[model samples]
Target: MSENGGGTARRRRRGSATVAARTGVAPNSGDILWEIFLRLPPQPSSLPRVSLVCKRWRRLAADPEFLIRFRAHHRKAPLLGLFKEYGGWVSFTPVLGAPDRIPRRRFSMRIDYGGGAETHPFHGTLLGCRHGRVLAVDPRRREVLVCDPITGDQRRVALPPEFGTCGGAHGAVLCADGDEGHVHGGCHSSPFKVVLVQISFGPGHPPPFARVYSSETGVWSDPILAAEGSRGYVDLSRPSTLIGNSLYWWLHGSYLCNMEILEFDVGRQSLAVINSLPVGDTVKSKGCIQIIQPEDGRVGFAMLSYPSLEMWDLKDDCGGGVAAWVPRKTMNLDLVPNMRVTEASIVGYAEDDDAILIKFNNNIFIVQLESMQSRKLYDCFVRHQYHPFASFYSSGSAKRKA
Candidate 1:
């Protein structure tokens, strides 16, 4: 991805209406053509077809600004696809087409594991995914693999201080460029932060050892302490969400039965905790959690309650009075008789849009956040999170689909 990162606006193709006016095309102006191209379905497969229409359209289709606008325009039509393990290898499937429709599983692509032709089994679990990229960890190999599933470009980073024989806590967040003191959501280079910690029990807790690695800095920071009683223990199995400058260890329950999200402010190098909705006895054993971003871009919580899914958006009261999560939407599964989700698990969270992927043992469906409507994705067995095609854009490359 070389030709990237100067913060250049090379792909911002604007002024289409003016050009069309000069060409004297009345009824269908260049602006109209441009809008049509911008409105082109964001299926990575359709862009090339639009590009083939003409050189002018090709230039607009490839423009970063246009791509960004297209995403925003269709943000409501979120559900891009699923990244799941198939036959011992991870692959991507675009089960989602346009909004308001549940398309069949038309096709899928095998994502190459760029860690060389490894004959060994990669027992790597997905840590987090965003912007068309994924961060996964192979605990056995003591390393983490960051890859762009769309392009097959990947890199490996070793675990910090090793996960050696101790109860360790770990998670990765696909954060944007937060090094410059602000969240550069689309400043371009897709960077992420990985956290590793030693879990200690009993009194004192010895400050709980921790370390972080940033893709931007390309090095692990000096060990930082997460204080004591931070959350009884960190579940490395669940992925974290990177919102603004904070990296969250989400969905952890406390002794009091309150769901919580531990905030690891990547910029301040500190830790804080936020409370989520309370758990009732009925769904206590049956429920699960997933961290997703809502329409406003704040961290949202999706709690799985057997027959229904509850969503709440977190709000921060800047004046230091009180911050709480307010209930936003609810999705009832009882409406869909075929979706007998006895053991539903959160498969994916599209932070860039309002769509989320939740799956039962064999059935998976994409739920739009706004409408809370669910649609089945045939053959989609939940899979790892991260991506809606937004992360594939880099300064050096374009889409591979035709």
Candidate 2:
């Protein structure tokens, strides 16, 4: 009886080991592993940590096809932080905490003027951020840089002679590959285009012109001038908004109350001005206006006046032209009894989340328009144009410190 029991116990142990080996090999299968990794949380460190699991895991995490599928599985890229430029030095403020809280220094870039006869007169200006690239202008050098904040990679595009000595140049960087099924935020390896708009105020200078630079073709298109006799200058401090195929910038007219919308149609390669203010001129003059796309996904603007926040969406006529600004919704900040609202100012808008960043009492808070939910992000003492940097960072170029 004792010998039989011993033999039975050995048989059971062999069966358990066989099952363990089968399960282990099954999880490591290409399809199974790929599916498992694709479901990982959409965070900056998600892939990096997975890569550390083993050599095979590392290779799978860095695979190009797998990376594309991983990003597509997660449509919306996570908002990592905000980029603010001061004195030619761009700094990043991390908004998320813990594993996603990228160190501010990781994304900071100090613009080098490269002392020369053609050195830029002023420091670099942070124009905008999109698809994981930050756009900045080297005015003295008469060039623009498309920089990847995550990998510290930069491609310099020399400015056209027509843009030389131009005043207040603002531009945007975007993926040049017009793939309708392509996902943005992770377009680090794709070709890109730089759309630069320069406004020259004095006579004998060309009217406001916008030029497009294509990376694939390695050339700039003919100057697309603004509408004949278009008068106004864009605020270098304000960022550009890209809605659909058009890019919008707030064009400030001669008078304080004169504010207009500057539109650059990427599809037609045309520039025009929309002369209208959704709210009263008082809010515009006070610099409380921000271009936004509400939940309904229409081009709009948000105005903040102390405790009250008003939003409006631009209605487009069937003729494919901007019709009017329709009121959307209003939120009263006074509802939060614990808050002391001394003064409020509009800082920027996060188009991905349909939220607006508001600064009040030296603190910055992101208020979502849909739910009217507000959450304090950072303690900002000074005013800076906050550019939302959202992306699905990969482990291949992971540079964040532990």
| Backbone clash count, each prediction separately | 2, 2
lDDT of 1 at 130: 58
TM-scores for all predictions: 0.69, 0.82
Per-residue lDDT tens digits for candidate 1, residues 1-402, read 546633333433225433433333332343576567656654545666667778887787776556555655554333445555434354455554443222212213323456445333345565555545566666566677776543445667887754552235656645554443222233334666666655554466554556787887889888777554544566655556666666776534455365556667766888655654554553453225676775453577777765778877777662586666677777676535774554566666665555666666666666777767777766544344433334322222533433
Off by over 4 Å in 2: 1-33, 54-56, 110-123, 200-207, 254-256, 281-286, 294-298, 318-322, 334-336, 399-402
Q: Model 1: residues >4 Å from true position, as ranges? A: 1-32, 54-56, 63-79, 85-93, 97-121, 162-167, 178-192, 201-204, 207-210, 251-259, 275-277, 292-300, 311-331, 338-348, 379-402
Listing every candidate in turn, what is its Cα RMSD in Å to the true structure after a full C-alpha superposition?
8.1, 8.7
lDDT string for model 2 (1-402, tens) is 999999998888767545533333322244577778878988988888988989999997887666766777787899999988888767788999888788877777644356433322235778889988888877777778788877766788888887774456778888877775587888877899889888755446556778999989999999898765345678978888888888988877676456677888999999876666655754745368888875454478878886878888777763567477678888787534687766578888887787888888788889888888889897888888899999887657655532
CA lDDT of each prediction against the hidden true structure: 0.56, 0.77
* Deviation from native of the Cα of residue 272 in model 2, angstroms: 0.7
